[model samples]
Target: MKKIFYVFSVFVLFSLVSCVTADNNSKKSADNSSKNAAIENILNRKSVRQYSDKKVEQEKIDTILKCAMAAPSGMNKQPWEILVVTDKEKLEKIAEIAPNASYSKNSQLAIIVCGDKNISERFWEQDCCAVTENILLAVEALELGAVWCMAYPSDERVAGIRSLFNLPENVIPLNIIPIGYPLTQEQPKQKYNADKVHVNNW
Candidate 1:
């Protein structure tokens, strides 16, 4: 009887340990799946210029904006504002202002990432760039298409955007991104360049 009781107790303990291990392994698998999805989003990201006619929903746009605002800023000043345009007429106006972004006319939504010099003068550009990149990645994760069109540093394009939008003197438009369903699928380019890498010394 003593021997049988000892073996039963051991069996119960082993079963409990096995159950705990299985639970931990399941949690780890879930965590790994989430991590892999994020990495895939970054790896497969591609510039998409051509877009289908599907209209983007307000909720998705809001989510993208949330992601953009989540980006880290200098001193956490977060001096960026996004102007989302879904109107056909307004999109056309932006296209005229930025010839390189003529694709905006085809997209259902256009996001203008602007920097407020009043918040952080010197770091505004870098902060805004981080926000723009977040939006791009969020768009990709959502299975949407987007193309970043340069607007700043160009006297002509900057002036045109400012004048058309009637933006304040302190607000400077950095870039325009048009988002929608992709009409063309593109493969991600491998950009791992060991030649440009320098460790400790150039």
Candidate 2:
């Protein structure tokens, strides 16, 4: 009886150590993968103004939108309305509406980030901005390029887009993003400034 009890104890200890080692390895692998993906997505992100003639796949576009929706909102209100535009004529008109976004004319797709004031009241703009950043990051992750074109706060641009889309009065256009395959490569430059950092207060 004593010999049998000793053997059982040894078996239990060995099994516990094995399970712990396996769990630690699995966690370490997951952590490394997450860290690498985040670094790659962030470091390679850059604005590409010029694009090739190639069309963006629908799957990638859907993934980008999914990522946009994954962003957190204030109080989880999620007061965002996304408008996807792919019509060639409309793309040309968008370029006309925002002169700085002339490169949009060549993009395969354009995403217009909008905020519905009726939903979150005051945090609509802030929530929309978070979604926009997620879209940009997803674009880079999918090996695509995009440029953000401001549309809000500009009466002319906002009115033009609203009129073109027949948007409701409560919906405000925030920005337009033109996405496509890059015509040229852009390297990410480090713009970090240590002086801008404040420990507790600015």
Q: What are the lDDT scores of the predictions, listed in order? A: 0.93, 0.93
Supply the global lDDT for candidate 2: 0.93
Note each model's CA RMSD in angstroms. Answer: 1.3, 2.9
> Could you estimate the TM-score for every candidate?
0.95, 0.87
Residue-wise lDDT of candidate 1 within 12-46, one digit each (tens)? 99999999999999999999999999999999888
Model 2 segments beyond 4 Å from truth? Answer: 1-23
Clashing pairs in 1: none
lDDT of 2 by residue, 40-127 (tens): 8887788988889999989998899999999999999999999999899999999999887788899888999999999988999899
Query: Could you tell me the C-alpha RMSD of candidate 2 in Å?
Result: 2.9
**What is the Cα-based lDDT of residue 147 in candidate 1?**
88
Model 2 per-residue lDDT at 121: 81
